[model samples]
Target: MSYERHFEYPLSASSRLTGSLALGDLETGQRCYREGRLSVDGGRSLPISLTHSPATERLMYGGEVECIEHLRTSLREMGVELPGSGGRWLPGPLLLGSERTRVTQAGVLDCMRSPAFEEALANRQEGEVVVLPVLREGMKYGLQEAVCDVLGAHCDEVVVDAHHVPDESVPYLGRRMELSVFKDADLTLAQREKVKVAILGDSVASGTVIIGLIEVIKQRFPNVERIELVAPLAAVYGLARIAAFGNEAVPLRAHVFESLLNALPPEYYFSPFFPEEEMHMAKRAYSNYRDWWGVDKAGKPIAETACAGYGWSEAFFNPRKQIAMIDEQLRERHGMGLAEVLGRY
Candidate 1:
């Protein structure tokens, strides 16, 4: 039972997280990852690869990859030449793939050929910024890479756009991974009763991680009920671009906060940030903050306390401090392996 049929496939699938979303085959499994896009419905047909027998023929019929190539041809035809020594491509919309096409690495390459896209790129003067939304670990990584290459070709000094990383990785940097949940464990009674949990960061990655944890916890603690996400929902990548390009005059942070208030249901209220809220509420509930390395064992309070002093008083003047703070926070809070902390609760 999918919540919404059309919006379901390219989403944070529950079955895959639980290891039940399989067709029980090997070649099909490879196809799921290797093939750019099997269907527009976000790789729903990918399970075929998991279930395919040894004799399963590779049906490379005019699938997602083909559509991506078409998008690339369209971009080139529209005159948005991605500048480079030779021609390489941006990965497609791996995260945003719908039923119409599995927007893979090649598909994003073709998007460059689109007339609307070219028009978007053409206006970039020396001091302008281009905001690109891409997947961290999947095919969309190519899109980020390609966009950077083109920006370098066109701009006088192209500064790469990066978002907040919970790893030792820098801010504005992008990480990559396949679409799958990395952990599965039951939650304790306290965790299940967490009526208010804050999802601090951004990205579809955050959504997947948060939802996966919720599902696991719910399964593990069936007796308890009512788990909630506390933070206002704002895409970190989008916020980063608005911050960088819109500059101080626009008050982007306040704007995003307002949008978040609007998007969410009326019951939720804005807190300082999820990390801060975790520090305040960790005593009452067993909360967690997740990142690329993996989920941590410490309570949300410990994580927030560790990151409290990060960032400079004046970020514009002390950008290096900002980066170092980011580095420190990631190193300190992330990198912990899963633990049996649930038993303590």
Candidate 2:
């Protein structure tokens, strides 16, 4: 069966696939592709060349298959390895990209222009990696569908991005939109004492998340003394609590990371780009690193969220979107490398 879906924004081929699972319809896109006949909307979505925002190229990352690989590595580290007898069944047949029938005409074109998309289309990359910020109706245009046409050009191993909704968009449109869905797992990992650790910046160690991890630590290392903690702030506190505790000390390892997560979940993931209409309507734009441009002094136009409205003008959306991806990848890779390095201790 083929999956029939709709999007408020224009989508790239890769992103369409990501959104497909959520669409929860028949996989018509696949069936149509096999039958060699599909009917889809015909439209062209333009790529942004230069605009008010910083210019950066967007890349697609992650997939169910990749998730499985990552999960395997994680499980293996936890001491569970699949046997050969388990066969391919343990790892299901992954979809290289969303089936073409799922995409509209313009989505196909955007996918063609993407190097990652092209590589996947040409059978160069492993497990279906594609590039995006795909133009859809609400966010991108028809870039999702184009990916469908291009996938066949590449080897069958390709994976599609398949996202329907625009990623969360904030005024700064940075990493702030990514949610930390695995905070519990993160605490568990930290509990293993497998990695050396360092804490940076100002943060609290008494937040709910921190308290939870501290309990875990207490259970694991009951007699560890004088936990050496280093931080800019003597103690971190919420706005309400900051005044009460002028200076305080808490176990460093237990609360630091958890506090950081509570302070910022969106900063950990990619922010979806909003449509021009939505962008213009925003009150302000926010980024994980810093605030973006704001409204004019006199306020030629004001958006709802003052911080977001003035901060996220449409001009910078494309550029900021691209730059965010590059920066995020570097951060992810670096942090992962750092984690592995620390784990060696």
TM-score of each: 0.20, 0.18
- The total of clashing pairs for model 2 equals 81
Error of 2 at 244 (Å): 7.4
Worst 10 residues of 2 by lDDT: 49-58
- Per residue, candidate 2 scores C-alpha lDDT tens digits across 1-345 of 222322222123232111110111111221111111111224211111111111010111111222345434443453444233221211001111221112212223432333322322354322222222211211222332433455442211111122212334422111121222212232333333321221111122222222232333334334322122211111111211221211223223211100011111222122222222211111122221112212224432111111111111121233233223332332353332212321322
Write candidate 1's Cα lDDT for 95-140 as tens digits: 1122112222333333333332343455444323322222222222
Error of 1 at 188 (Å): 48
lDDT for position 44 in model 1: 21
